[model samples]
Target: MHLIKSNWKIALGVIPALLIYCIFSIIPIFISFYYSFMSWNGFSAMQYVGLANFKAILNDSVFWLSVRNNLIVVAASVFGQIPIALVLALLLNQKIKGAKFFRTIAFLPVVISTVVISLTWRLIFNVEQGLLNNLLDNLGLSALAQNWLGNPDYAMYAIAVVIIWQFVGLYFIIFLSALQTVPRDILEAADLDGATEWQKTRYVTLPSIWGVIIIAVILCISGSLKTFDLIYVMTGGGPANSTEVMATYMYTETFQGLRYGYGSAISVLIFVFSIVMIILANVLLKKRGNRKPV
Candidate 1:
């Protein structure tokens, strides 16, 4: 009773936020789980369909295609974007003139709204009057000038490039902050030991910032998995759904196809995939951390 009384103010302070979270986040997730087991058209009535929605999703080809595209995005984000961000961060972390200006320019894309970025890239990628094709034509590289966002073979890659370009700044800032946290003493020690620049980075800088790298990887995975807005604005999963991802696929199923139950199942799968990937990443990183150095 004494403990409860002492914490009453804290409880009261938390109630509003707790209530909002339950109402906006928890309840919708529960509702989606319930709806996943039923056939609903968003109109007349929901019919209890048992595992029918799951069955349908299992056999969905386009759904699998979307999953493949999502995996591609995840790969590009973690492998392509994060490494480049790390390099930029390392360079910018040095005691160089105009470092702050370079950092600001690098992070500028992260502050821009995704919708605006998508629209800007869309114009740049336009085949005829756009900047890229015009540059190619002027350089006598007309053969390389093709419809970047329209060709099925290249559309997904094009979108992936835009995604990487737009968000590398975010991870760069994150890595830069991490790099700044590294102990200057350790770097000095490494220099005294005659460690080459590469040796210093590989042994001191990277290992010191491993935790931040892991967090960046997790962010890349989660963000890539749930990516929707940019793809929607840019491609709408177009050119025969070549650029489709899980979020866009779910939206298409629910709103466009009116397959509410199926879409709910897709949502549930997205939640599960995200959870599994996060867990696996944590486990792998933990194991790596626990390993004794040679």
Candidate 2:
């Protein structure tokens, strides 16, 4: 009774947010799941398709190719972005000169519009007059320059690079915050025990922020799965759809191809995949955390 009386205002505050979440997030997901079983262009009468879309998607080569591309993006994000972010976070967490300035510079890319970043990189990846090719020529390595975004073999990699560059800053900020929260006494004790900086980092710093790392891992996985805008603006899943990921492919199917039902199916799959990955990550992390000696 006392708790309710004291925290009633706080509980009231969440109602508005809960209402907004249900209206915008929860309702839309249910609608999409419902629509996944129906065939309906925006202007046409709906027809019940009843798993036909899922069956078709199973047989579709392009769909699987897009899934493969999404997996690549996920791998790049989990492996490439997380490690780079950790390094940047660790470096910036030091008591160095101009730390704030460097942190700001590192985080600047995350706040920029996706379209802007895509267009900026688009010029950089251009074959003939692009920054990359020009730099190669200036370095006398002209033979090394190739069409980064045009060739099917290289297009997905180019997109993955852009994706990693744009989002690493966000993860860096998360890691930096976690790093700052590590208790100073523990670090001092490690130093007194004659631990090197690398040893302290691996043993003390990382273990202290393991939960944050797991959360960041889950965020990276989910974000990589939903990648769309930059790839859309840069490649439009083009050069023969080599750069296709789930969200862009979903957009193409629904808005461009007008296969609303099939697109809904794809969206559902994306949601399912994201949930599964997050759950697996959480379970694995929790298990590992439990096994670790206090």
Candidate 3:
């Protein structure tokens, strides 16, 4: 009772925010959860079916393919996007000329509309006369020119590159923010100790921003699971479902195929997978942080 009275002001201040959260997030989540047990074609009456949809999803080959693609995208984001972003952040964190300008330029892609990038890359990857193929042909590398979107083997990878290019700037910004907080004293001490640049970075810089790394890993995992727009615009999960992430597959099932229950099952699976990854990442990060030099 005493604690509640003491914190009443703060609780009162949070009331509006709590209300907004309830309206926007909580309500919709509950609705989705409720709809998950039903079969509905958007405008039609919903038919409640217990775990049938989930069972069906478990047996779905294309669904599994979508899951596989999502995992691949997540792996690429974790390994490729973040490492490149960290490298860029490290470069920008140094006392280089026009570092701020370079940071802004790198981040410009993130702010640019995904639809625009999708359309632009779609043209670049065009089989007939796209710039990529055209350049390759001009340089006498015509043999390297192949159908990027039309081919099943290369389609997912191509989309993954686009995804990476589009969001690398976001991660770059995250890394830059973390890099900015590294203690100058530690760095100066390392320099005074005759530590090589790589040695200083490996020992000092990486340790300081571990929290950011963990957050980036979580974002990568969740973003990969929920990716929709760019892939929606680029391939529509096409080329024989080769590029079908769970998001795309779920969208197709719910809206196109009129399988709301099944779509919900996919969403649930994605939610579960994301939760598992986040928990695992947290464990790993905590262990790494504990093992850091005291």
Quick one: best TM-score, which candidate?
A: 2
Which stretches in model 3 have alpha-carbon errors above 4 Å?
A: 1-13, 43-45, 292-294
lDDT of each: 0.92, 0.93, 0.89
Q: What are the per-residue Cα lDDT tens digits for candidate 1 across 119-180? A: 99999999889899999999999999989999989889989899899899999999999998
Q: For model 3, state the Cα shift of residue 68 in Å.
A: 0.5
lDDT of 2: 0.93
Rank by lDDT (best first): 2, 1, 3
Model 2 lDDT at residue 47: 98
Best by lDDT: 2
> Can you write out model 2's per-residue Cα lDDT over 1-294, one digit (the tens) per residue?
988886998889998999999999999899999999999898889999899999999998898999999999999999989999999999999999999999999899999999999999999999998999999999999999999999999999988899889999999999999999999999999989999999899888998999999999999999999888899999999889898888998999999999899999999999999999889988998888667554
Clashes of each: 0, 0, 0
The TM-score of candidate 2 is 0.96
Per-candidate TM equals 0.93, 0.96, 0.92
Model 1 segments beyond 4 Å from truth? 1-15, 291-294
Enumerate residue pairs that collide in model 1.
none
Q: What is the C-alpha RMSD of each candidate to the true structure, in Å?
A: 2.2, 1.6, 2.5
What is the C-alpha lDDT profile of model 3 across 1-294, one tens digit per residue?
989886998899999999999999778667767777888777778899988778888899999999899888988888889999999999888899998899999999999998999999999999998999999999999999999999999999999999888889999999999998999999999999999999998899998898889999889888888899999999999989999989899889988888777787788777888899889988997898779574
- In model 1, what lDDT does residue 97 have? 100
